[model samples]
Target: MIQHSLDALARFSAPDDDQLKALHNSIISLSTEGCGPRECRALLNVFERFPDHDGDGLFSSIVHLLEPCTGYETMLIKSVGPASVPFNALMSDRLLNSGVTEVGGQSLMALLAAAKAHH
Candidate 1:
């Protein structure tokens, strides 16, 4: 299902809102049904390439959905950028509360890099 949506996404040079929404729905559905590594990677790939046309809301929603899945913190951290204010806030909150670990460290560094890039 996700692969089909992803293929559809790839076909478009500039996807319309409906296309984006379709991909979004597919990701959400797959995540809820237990997103595995392959599914996570595909979803992350979508995030990596696709622009969040509906403000940052779409990206934020996907991030929130995927955050608890485990084994993908590094990828998720790397996916965030300064443009998504909601993601920055979420990462900041996570950093403040999360103990010093590899994932936390990566999130902090990604946030710093994004801040630097933004400025």
Candidate 2:
């Protein structure tokens, strides 16, 4: 799914709705639960390339996901409002700055604040 998202970004092919939904869930997990740096780095790089990708409704999915965030996604979204920045950029920044390694043990509010500082 990650590779598909990255490939979709690279080849200018819009991912299917299923892929977009998976991407949304994957991003939500990445933001809220944390993952290895290698994984985070790969996902972040992939996401960084997506702001210009069209046809997949990526941005709209992001907005929709963030609008009704189920968990930590809500805290993060509220930091800057769901519309404050492009979702790809915001997620990449959050991955890099949010000290995600500490995610499950810490309040997302602080992590989001860290992300907000950089955004």
Report, for every candidate in turn, its global Cα lDDT versus the true structure.
0.57, 0.46
Summarize candidate 1's per-residue lDDT along 1-119 as a digit string, tens digits. 66664564355334467765675676667665766666666656655455444323566666665667666666655556554344443554575467633464564655656665874
Q: Which runs in model 1 stand beyond 4 Å of their true positions?
A: 2-15, 51-56, 77-97, 104-107, 114-119
Instruction: Name the weakest run of 10 consecutive residues (lDDT summed) in model 2.
Output: 74-83
Error of 2 at 83 (Å): 24
In candidate 2, what are the lDDT values of residues 8-106, reduced to their tens digit?
Answer: 334433466766666666665544544443333444344344545543655554444343333534343343333334554355356546554333355
RMSD of each: 4.2, 9.5
Q: Considering every candidate listed, which one attains the maximal lDDT?
A: 1
- In angstroms, how far off is 12's CA in candidate 2? 12
lDDT of 1: 0.57
